[model samples]
Target: MTEATVGEFTTRASSINRALDQIGDKWCLLIIQEVLWGINSFNEMMAAMGVSRGVLSNRLKWLQEVGCLRREEGVAGSHRPRYHLTSKSIALYDCAMMAITWERDWYQTPALDRVELVHLPCAKPFVAQLRCACCDALVCLRDVSYQPGPGATRDVREKKVRRRSSIAITEVRSEHALYRNLINVVGDRWTSNLIALSFHGLTRFEQFHQELPVATNILSDRLKLLVEEGVLEQVVYQQRPLRYEYHLTEKGQGLFPWFLTLLQWGDTWCDPQGRGKPMQVTHNPCGEQLQAQVHCSECHGVLKAHEVRFTLDGEDMNP
Candidate 1:
């Protein structure tokens, strides 16, 4: 379908959309990850992420402006200031865990394999798992429902949507970086938005275009990329004229936890109008509003940043 042929449809300026608007770029996410790993200085992030100095500086300022990061005084004699995660960004820990879980499930990430996530409460290395806050049952894509909430309102699409960066996250030089594949999929705003919409049961091309309203070519390209990455599979839904519908593969559904955690974080930190959450997610099994919690697979305890230790090569890394 052509962009002009597609009809205008109302798209909610949901918390997730707002959230993506702030940190959806590859450079922005890489910068955040670097800071999370305690790589704080401008030079450090630039070198570690293999990002241009201009881009790194811009993303750092943007992150600080969005409240995801804050600038702090340099230590001792260092003249360069440090960037620290705000409470808003620290809350992204669960989302990060979910991303790691999905990455490990789909790819043989050497960096992630060498690192162990130890649940201090359990004192055992554990994989991250998502469970519903209502009944503690595991959350699956099929067992969830979406409903419009108080803040449901149309987003004003820019007449000229800013084009996303073409640079791949895999191009980043950080061998210690986790979630390279996940970042490649979601680092672009359009790709990430499509993934989020899939969780709401959007399947057809027309349905996706209505919610996203990007140029048709851009939409098509992202869908094609998703298919190539094994996150989506195109199913023949109509025999005539070769019409198809896109459905999430098992790999795609595995991303539900990451998006779920991101949604919750956005609800908490990205509501500019305080209109309340734009969407209400219900856990079908428990019949209660879905509250996502990332926990240890071994002990089933909710994870806390301070209570988890990351070990690399048998040495404990910083919390």
Candidate 2:
């Protein structure tokens, strides 16, 4: 295997990294979002996303390879094949909904407000809430901690140098899709890790550097990207040299649940030994251990994969 691909295979055994590697790119998440919205055919997805046909084709192939989606041949004489979400991708609905909730609260815009999700069983407009699966209490940053899991690997020296790809988001139009915008903000590992650290009260550049061990240039690039995306704002803390600290904006803070959900998933699945969770979470309000769980807005019942249905423009789509 190529050196870079080898590095990815070894490091991405961690569930969170695997998840990000699969769906965290600028186009992958957008493609999944579009598929969920019922844009299935290649032509439809290409038109809706305004993405180059080559990029779209590549992402679709990757998603299918990863078992998140599948393609079915078109009827008898048709040339187009329809893309459908597999159970794996369907399970990501909670994550996407949590993202939308965050956007609704902190990144409000006219275009965003036009899209809405209604729980078919509830028949009322509502937002997703993250509750502790064990005790049914809300979860927060203070409630969690982490350690190495079964899949954890000690740091290794690279056998070869890898080139960095240029950031693609800069070329995307400002008026592009909201999910695409969100992807630009936190699509990369360093940026997402920095945002998660911000929730743990890390702000200064030095603090992020110490916790992450990322290269100076890479860390700087991610911080600048976050600032430009408005997820983080820089405040001057030292005047003489104009040194600054990175602080999470409302938009960044609102992403807590999304990251928290990812953490919970990693802690559960990545640790095979049952030795212990990589992270332990406690619901402060209830003073009990926690796991992030999605619930129905109206009934307050657990939102299981099979129990829910979807609607697009008031038309029911089978889940």
TM-score of 1: 0.93
Q: Estimate, for each residue in 104-216, the C-alpha lDDT of model 1 and write its tens digit.
A: 99999888888998999889999999999889999999999989988888865443355555567777788557998998998877889899888888999999988776779
Question: What overall lDDT goes with each candidate model?
Answer: 0.85, 0.68
The regions of model 2 sitting more than 4 angstroms off are 1-14, 109-111, 147-152, 155-178, 210-215, 235-242, 265-277, 304-319
Return the clash pairs for model 1, or none.
Answer: none
Model 2 gets an lDDT of 0.68
Give residue 129's lDDT in candidate 2 (0 to 100). Answer: 79
Record all residue pairs in model 2 with backbone atoms less than 3 Å apart, i.e. clashing: none
